[model samples]
Target: MVDPLLLQLAAAGAAIVGFGWLALAMDVHWEQAQGQRPQPAPVVRLLRVLGSLALAASLGLCLTADHASMAVLVWFMLLAAAVLTVAMTLSWRPQWLRCLWP
Candidate 1:
């Protein structure tokens, strides 16, 4: 079995990446990002695909990391971390998000 901590970190990474995909899918967010304009349709589509994949991977990480109950806790905790990271990044350094999307 995988280390729970490692799985937690992976989950966090996935959430962040998923957030990037979410950001890429939005026009308004792009407009506000540092030097980033709206992406083309193909790019948006790609982002959607990647975002979904990342989120799914996060779930997989959690489930495989531990038993069901522990996995649920770790997964949700990592998700919260990911959300906080995204929110903080968007608030303080949206340019960073543009870097990911662009």
Candidate 2:
């Protein structure tokens, strides 16, 4: 089995990317990050799929690190953290998020 700390860290990364992708799928956030008006339909679709998969991967990693009961709680906390991080980044420095995709 992988080290719990490593797995948890990976989970955090996946969650952050997941939320970031979800935010970028939105026109406003995409414009903020991409400096454009409206994202392409195909890119939006792909982003949504990738975002959901990343979130699922994050949960899987969390489960691998802890008991199922605790994993759910931990996943939620991680999700919250990821959301805040993404939101703050988007608000303050959306260009940083460009690295996530571009």
**Which candidate number maximizes TM-score?**
2
lDDT of 2 by residue, 1-102 (tens): 689999999999999999999999898899899896557899999999999999999999999999999999999999999999999999899999898778
lDDT per residue for candidate 1 within 1-102, as digits (tens), equals 667788878877897889777776778766667454546898878888998889889988888878889888877777778878877887788778866764
What TM-score do all the candidates reach, one by one?
Answer: 0.84, 0.96
lDDT of each: 0.78, 0.94
lDDT for 65 in candidate 1 is 76
Highest-lDDT candidate: 2
Off by over 4 Å in 1: 34-36
